[model samples]
Target: MTTYNTADHSDFVRQLYAFAAHIRDPKKNPCPEALEERRMKIYRELFYNNVESFISSSFPVLRQIMMHERWHGMIRDYFANHLSHTPLFPEIPREFLKYLDHERIAQPDDPPFILELAHYEWVELALSISDEKVEIATINPKGDLLDGIPVISPFAWSLSYRFPVHKISPDFQPRAPEATQTNLIVYRDADFAVHFIEINAVTARLLQLISSNDHKSARTLLQQISVELNHVQADVVVRGGMEILSDLRKRQVILGVRV
Candidate 1:
């Protein structure tokens, strides 16, 4: 009997790849009409339905807008083209969003804001399932609230989008706003449920700077915003901004400001 060497194993591996690919999509195989045709139908349907159900459950609102055919087509294309990072079925939604971020789907042209909206939509469940716990260090609440650095929760996310996705209603499918952008702060409250708050540019900057571990004083943060606005006196903005910071600290939104 002849022994099979590495070259023989390599040939076997290539053939195996071909066989598996053919079984995955039997239409790609040049097998007998009866043999491959029967299996192709079952395989295709199973693949399409599984992905469709996964996406539909995760993005019910997006599913509601598209017709059945259109929705399934999107999933079909995603499964066929997108390179998934995880083998776990539950991670499919995350992979789908990753695909959407890069792949142009076959529907109403998804605006730039659509990516952010999808992420925002997905975050509710993502946060619920996330295993990473935030360990916030203790801070003196009565001390210089601005002096202590504020650390936003690791799970918390701040997003600004061209469209007001959160405000989307049955009657109104939000289009990209022409006037100004909207900012949203998504954070898990003390109760552990995720909450979203609509915030202004100033507040967004303040939170972002604090999260960045920037060493600027709360007074400096306000002064910077005031100068950027070319407002009257810096003290007025600083005083008001400190009050806002104090409220944020009280709410536990700002972990703490070092004195």
Candidate 2:
């Protein structure tokens, strides 16, 4: 006949979290003593492997370049430290990006382009499963884009990063940011295939203006760009912008003009 401490149950739960935390990053926390070593090892491996699999699938390029030890350490730190806002498994990759953006401090050995590359990879995955919808009937695929209001596709995104994220790979990681910014548009086509196109500063600004949906026609938007850019030849700028709009329509980035 023995009396159990009321705190014992709570203590066990706390210890379980502690042990799990330690399993994620042993350097930062201690292992629980209550669990058998063999069984704890199994729990640790199982949990770490599942997380590693998700991260690896989401960021295949990052995984290939990082040595196992460093990659595992980074993942472990994320698992242990980040307090994710969402509990959904599908959002883990996005949450990991948030952690990298907001929480993770840069390590001397870590590539400077790591955050940008991770963001680029995450955007691909995010757009792939996006539930956003648009009505095709409202768009005029062959409309005069210059005079008509250009409607940006719901699936299109114009992203600018300090690093040339699209080009970074294991073999071509850059230690420093390029002098010029990298501007890219990632869009899902009619076939549902996601693709990215590199664009210049003016085009990037034009997309931003179009996204405002301010009841401005494509010609007006282009004019605004030309004025803001202080181009010597506004008509030339507008004409070039018109061609760009036509190409964007073909790519489905600009979902034609609103009728």
Candidate 3:
């Protein structure tokens, strides 16, 4: 058996750290002298490529809208910095979002809506892979949305952004934030397909109420919203809320009323 001294073990650990550091950021960290340069080159490329590929897939719309060099540079920054909380590959998108949200320093050329776009794309990926299962039988498919307690699907997410993230693509990247905030409900249907619907502030608030309350009927929630809105004709608000509720049910944002 080969017995290693403490000094030898310390040196080996230092070398490992150096190797990882260099792989994460060759421009800043020096490669370990013990590493073969040719082999290290292959290793570094493989590791960076894998991280870049995962991020690229996770934020396809963000990738599409960004300049190629800028996008890769951002990925390299993420690869070199953000320490992920989980080891799962499926969680990389969430990790990347963390990097974007807290780690990254924005660049002059980067889109104003970059973070929102990345988040929106991440939302779709999250809904597709989420483990939360919805039981259709517990919900009444034909129940009156206004009379019965409206049930927001576990897979449905109500999101609000300063930019129209869903509308972002290579063709239309807004240089500045929109005057009004964009509200969206992204949901996974019975077939497990992720979809998004743009909604107004009232609709967003109604969904928020549904998510927070289990005892309130849709009509009750809408009436509260009308009072909040200070609408002169509360009945008009309720009628509009009913129409939106019916539409949301069809879209799977509201799965149905609870049994």
Per TM-score, the best of the predicted structures is 3
Which residue segments of model 1 deviate by more than 4 Å? 1-44, 105-113, 138-143
Q: Which stretches of candidate 2 lie over 4 Å from their true place?
A: 1-19, 22-34
TM-score of every candidate: 0.78, 0.88, 0.91
- Which candidate leads in lDDT? 3
Worst 10 residues of 3 by lDDT: 1-10
lDDT of 1 by residue, 1-259 (tens): 1122235468666555554454444444443333466776676677767777878888776766556776666776676557676888878878888888887553565444556667777886677667776554455445676555555666677788777878664455766574777888776767778878888888887777676665767767777889988989988877877887876655656666453
Tens digit per residue, CA lDDT, model 2, 1-259: 1123236578866776677676766665556777777887887789888987998999998888888999988898888778877878889999899989999888889888888899999999888889898888888878889999898988999999999888887778888888999999999997889999999999999999998865888788888888898888889989999999999998989887887
**Model 2 per-residue lDDT at 139:** 85
Candidate 3 lDDT over residue span 1-259, tens digit each? 1122235568877677778888888888877788889999999999999989988888888888878898888888888878877989899999999888898998877788888888999999999999987787889978999899998888999999999988888899888888999999898997989988888999999989988998989899999998999989889999999999888888878878989
Sorted on TM-score, best first, the list reads 3, 2, 1
Q: Is candidate 1 or candidate 3 better by lDDT?
A: 3
Residue 137 CA error for candidate 2 (Å)?
Answer: 4.5
Candidates' lDDT values, in order? 0.68, 0.86, 0.87
Off by over 4 Å in 3: 1-11, 135-138
What is candidate 3's CA lDDT for residue 84? Answer: 79
Residue 58, model 2, lDDT: 96
